[model samples]
Target: MKLKRTMAILMAGVTCAGALAGCGGSGSKDTGSAASNSGGLTELTFVMASRDEFMSSIEEAMVAEAEPLGYKIVSQDAQNDSSKQIQYIETAVNGGAEAVICLPVDADGTQSLIDAVGEKNLVFVNRPPTNYSELAADNVTYVGSNEDTSGYYQGEYLANYFKQKGQKEVKYLMIQGTLGQVSTTKRSEGVIKALKDNGINPVEASAPVVADYDRPTAQEMIQPLLTSGKEFDCIIANNDAMALGAIEACKDAGVEINFPIVGIDCTADGAKAVQDGDMAMTVFQNPVGQGKGAVIAADNMINGKKLGTGMEELGALDTSGKDYSDSIFWIPFEPVTKDNVADYM
Candidate 1:
């Protein structure tokens, strides 16, 4: 989809839920801000794109971490709609949010919304900017795993694993998310480049199925691909949800081929599947730290403490060229198979 740049793409609104549910008492809890700090209760709004279990867990952990430091958390779920995500951001901006943490649904389109909101009230999660140089102008400080590196590592590991197993040509299929988004674009490029470097020509499917990052839609998309009379040895899923969907599709189609499924995002179910020999490997994205980091940095900024600047202000902040030391922070990636599943778990 062509991302719009005009004002028509900007938005901010709330859905049916006043606040997102499903945050149990499993996160880090504090009695209250040490009781000695002078900062009063700070109100923060988090605008997330969807309701994945991993995202929710991170949200809860963030809430727990923030509450102890005298901060209240208000979250808005955009349901993976770019317009709605922008709208939620607008709402946060208008509502006088001290700071906003967002997981952008449409990576490119939200650049304008971030620009409109200004720097005093913006932080990003999961998705970072393609042009990090412009992040500060739009008021975004992004915190997430490196998509390209993660995908490249997954591809390299899978290829080497198959190579050692006496496989000559490895046929690969990609179940991608929305087109042109930073994550999807980088992940696809990384995977393809890795396969090509290893002398493998991956088969390109006719169309990339976009499930809007939903599991049910991914399941629907995979059922057809699994039975399309095409033989694929490796399935490179953009996320674990899609990986699981493809696995389900394989089971339903009764295909006994020993296909290795690789995915990003180390959720519990994905890890469990790896343990059970269903999935080959996955990248462990540190979702839990997303909210917490944003809040900490925003709080530091508010508290007059110096924070690491983004790529936009690197020269101004760090003349020694250390600001951009590693903009793309990665958690870790474990090549989880039946052998290492127990260790990872």
Candidate 2:
């Protein structure tokens, strides 16, 4: 009787513990329960800063990638406006989006997003927000390319071209992106450093002429550069949109593009220009990969899987931790000149 009583007591203890665990699992306060839902069938909203053709391509690609996985990707284009971006974020949150993928035009524009998401995840693509270290909490990852490295390559390519031609000095026109943006600043710095290294001191032309990544603005800006009678050895634009505009301006001025021009974002038009020898080269930022990576990271976050290989985890996408220093998801960048444009096209 004593032995049977002891066995009965042990079984009773195990049963009680299992019952307690079941109750805890059903409670809304369970953290593990929340983490497990992170990878489920989630509704994600991708808010881009503009409605340009590049972003359209990203949207199309993202739709194709998300459909098979049973996820919905709703896009909100802010048209380069900060207030509009904030509104879109609010809308996404209100609509119960599980995650948000943003391309903030201004670094500090998305602070409210962090507040709204709370435990939900947010992935900043293309541009990481400012002061992200303290802002990014448990569920956030940035997926994009290294702007400085790509810029360095752009600079090196332009510098080498100048040197190969044996030009004593090159007077270049720089059409930069918005001031204070990390992407714009880093790229311009790289180009400037490369030009100096090549025995060429470049004149910092107008304040990037404020093209706003629009072809019309770039075209208008370039017309003045051509009409001003200022001789420029090359027109180095921060993006292919501006470069295309410069090409149009060159055509209107009846000035043949003799100097080698350099640009970033090897879009379809950029590749065509390179093939025609109207533009020198472009650094291709793989938009397809950028979109796919963001979706994959969000899915992993939902699944409770760590953001990296077995040994690592990525922090917030902003310039914060040593974790993202080796983010393997970074897409590759390549210089596409006339030689390589044919293959890429």
Winning model by TM-score:
2
CA lDDT scores, all candidates in order: 0.62, 0.66
User: How big is the positional error of residue 261 in model 1, measured in Å on the Cα after superposition?
Assistant: 1.5
Query: Which ranges of candidate 1 are over 4 A from the true structure?
Result: 1-40, 205-209, 309-335
Which run of 10 residues does model 2 get worst, by summed lDDT? 5-14
For 279-319, candidate 2 gives per-residue lDDT tens digits of 89998776765676667656655555554322112222332
lDDT of 1: 0.62
Which stretches of model 2 miss by more than 4 angstroms?
1-41, 132-136, 205-208, 309-329
Task: Report the C-alpha lDDT of model 1 over 14-42, residue by residue, as the tens digit.
Answer: 11111212012111111122112235656
